[model samples]
Target: MTQDATAVAAAKVAGVVRELTARVMQYDATRDRRAVFAYTYFRLTSDLAANLRTNTLSFREPEWVADLSVTLAAAYSTAMDAIDSWLGLGAARPDGAPGGEVRAADMPESIPKPWRDVYAASTVRHSYVLEEVLFSMMAHMSYDLPLALRALDPAAHGDLRRHIADFHRMNDLLASSVDGVQDEISARYCRRLHSLDRLFTRDDELFTSYGIRVARGMAWFNCHRLLDPDAAAEAQGSISRSTAAFIAEFRSPDDWKRRHAFRVLRALVPSRRQWPPAGTPPA
Candidate 1:
């Protein structure tokens, strides 16, 4: 799709996800936070993916690019933690589990007042499972960029043709995991996501370890989120640089940070200071 077309599609998908999220949050507010978090998380990441894809300018457009990237990256980090908290993962919980005082029975109290209680229960967990598949599709894309890039002949100098062909196969698999994605998500991408999910589902521990790295890195990123633009620049510069030094067991030197997107695909872990903050939830 053209950049403009891509932006429009992303906006539409985001709106649908948000609307779906609000409805689900009202029914089982407790378990549904996971869906809400994933909804927003995918929105932000999709936004960034769009932004990153619109590299229509020079990297020297550092002022424009860095400012936006830092802010959006911070937003992505926040949404990620929110997702983990909803899932009962990360520093948001005791021992980093998302489980809390809220239980399945406690859902009604956790429900948002803005939504209709009647419609809420109907779509609770199933909606979340649907999002899990969509986000899984997204995570697959965001994470595999590096490896797919490596498979390129390297003659194209980061040209995306080969990468898209290979990575998109995974994208299709992820899309297929969602129930209606065949109608909405591309049929090709949906089929690919389903296939890839099957391949990776059995490798839970490896994925979890990778997720831990991403969460920790994001926590480090979020601690710096409230900083002003210049500071954000310096901070992201440090991160981009650190990502430079952050060797991956997988990735060639030339594409190290670019490939590190897999690590960044997971939720951001919280810094020690952000935990509980004295009166919030107990650790």
Candidate 2:
């Protein structure tokens, strides 16, 4: 097929896949949902960033891929930071009150370091590949919950589309901004894109050939908005144990080792003094 025809076909297939993805979400019996909503928010943001990255350039350009990688890295970093900040706050406020903080000991015991590492290292300086992988996992969860809500409720689906589209339309351009001074970064990005496009596009094509794209469209409708924040939290809390189990039982060592940035200073800082002996705030 010609390039233009191919693009159109790809888009159409993606849309069908999105709809199907929404459909599959209807079957999630396990209530744990935080990761799902998180994925929806993160990817919707990623999609928005991707659009901005490619707004002026055609995908055929080698430069287009580089610009996108730089863009993805930066966007993912900022998004990850935002998520961490929020999660930090949530852990600190279990009773909905302030003052108490997220204790390190409170961290889930079985949590995979890779998952947490992905969380810790998610910075805009990196590309979207990691973000894509992380979100893909969440997308699996999203596929089951809010998506089902959309199918059963038109208002739910309509609201979701509108919200996601709006967020995607407006967000900070960290990657582009970072490239403002580093002129050669785009060149590096393009080279990486050439390699990655082959991988992602290949998977996309295989899914398409198998008629799966008509069901799980990567760049299509993205209708996960039917899930509200409350639902997501309740779902997350419910699944913490199961998620913990999956991490310990299924994660590979490669996954854990692939993501740590050497923190030269993090370990050097003085430790907190035993929480000041319970209630003694004495000087």
Candidate 3:
């Protein structure tokens, strides 16, 4: 695609992301746990969109990147839409009434299993916000990302190395967004997150960034496996099983112990002054 074409595609994708962000913010207001991930996703996509518009990163294949963004965002949007429809919250309902009884078996096959797990967990009152967000991240990054890459077929565009380089460049963007995203989550969902952050200090950001780096690195490896004709079938199953297992681990009882430890540690530490002061809140 030409530069002009890429610009148009990027703009369209940005519009889609903007709409999804609005929907997710509304969900957040309703105390929907899924918003944990959705809000974080919006933050990351907003940063990506800004970079795309300003050509800040000078990505080797901006067009391919833009297309992948659309694919990945569309997958999330589609999964959320399916869940909404199943739950009778779809916009298509004229009276704002339930869409009527629907069984899980009736859900569209296009909505992947990882996303199903995400929506299911969102209904649990005891689910931690951090775990919800991580589950959503795993679904998007670990499960959907490699498939999105395969769908785009990077080799058809040009040199595969250029595509890989652009992919790694995204790691820097993810790392930079961690602190801001954590702040948003703290303010909107869990205020105690501030105390937790003070306990860990900069190590909090470092750990989150490291996790993003590792997950994305695995995604790229999976992308290569998906592209391999002989490995494709096994790769598909592995992606689903591995993502589900990762999410299961997050739901384990041991996580409760870890969370309890953080709470105890936070209580033992002195509280630090929060940013923007008491009178001036985040806009």
Candidate 4:
């Protein structure tokens, strides 16, 4: 696509992102732990989508991979809708609605139960920003993403490949944003220990690499599985188990080593005592 066409294509996608971002910011994710993640994802996806749309960020092939942008944005938008419904911010629809253009006609039918399971567990803000981000990634990449890819024509394997690249690119974007995201999380949920942000950075490279690899694996596996349902069924347990393990790690309050380290750090720092302090109150 030409430059003007490319901009035009991304324009619609950008507009949708603006709308979703507003919804995300408007919702008070402060009271509920789940809302923290809801807000995190909404903000993350909104930024990424807006970037991709304007060509401020470049994926493998912007013109050819435009669908990837729209589809992924739609997936995030749908999840946001799910959050709103679950939290009663908007009208709930037990049956999912594929909220954006370029989404599967039967997205509700294609979405797996695991997606809902993770969202449901977000009721308490036990997980750190990183863990919450991972949980959201698991649901979207493992469950929602495959269905989105599967909805594409099998012959369009080339398109699928580009989308996979776009997926990892977004993962890289997540890696880049970890510090900012953690700041947001700390501001909202970890007000007592925002100064210890360094605790979460030790495993940053490993975490980003692992997340990108897993997203690629899930996308490929799902695309192939769509071509062969019986084979996918045979291997379903393995897929479910792998995804379950990732989710299990984040779902538990005690899963993050950084949190433990922060506790130890807090003990060593004298001034850190008196959380919420005398004059400043917790948000």
The prediction achieving the highest lDDT against the true structure is 3
> Candidate 1: worst 10 consecutive residues by lDDT?
269-278
Separate clash counts for every candidate: 16, 15, 0, 2
lDDT of 2 by residue, 79-193 (tens): 4344345556554322222433333234443433223333322221222332233333432322322233344334553443433322222322322322231222113213242
lDDT of 3 at 71: 87
lDDT of 4 by residue, 66-180 (tens): 5655666577667656545544533222222222111122234233455555543333223344444556667666765665666664564535654666656666775676556
Model 1 Cα lDDT, one tens digit per residue, 1-283: 3455445534544443444344334323333333332333344334334433453321222222223333433433443334344444222222222433322233332322111111122123222232333333233223222222223323534333323332333233223333432222223113333443443343222223344344333433333331334454554344333321222222222456544542343223211111112222100
TM-score of each model, in listed order: 0.22, 0.24, 0.75, 0.61
Residue pairs clashing, model 4: 33-125, 34-122
Best by TM-score: 3
lDDT of each: 0.32, 0.31, 0.66, 0.51
| Residue-wise C-alpha lDDT for candidate 3, range 98-202, written one tens digit per residue | 343233244556568777666555444334555566667888888888877777874633245557878878888778788788888677667776655454443
Q: Quote the lDDT for 220 in model 1.
A: 31
Quote the lDDT for 30 in model 2: 21
At residue 271, candidate 4 shows an lDDT of 28
lDDT of 2 at 273: 12
Local error of candidate 4 at residue 248 (angstroms)? 2.8
Error of 1 at 249 (Å): 26
As a whole number from 0 to 100, the lDDT of residue 251 in candidate 3 is 42
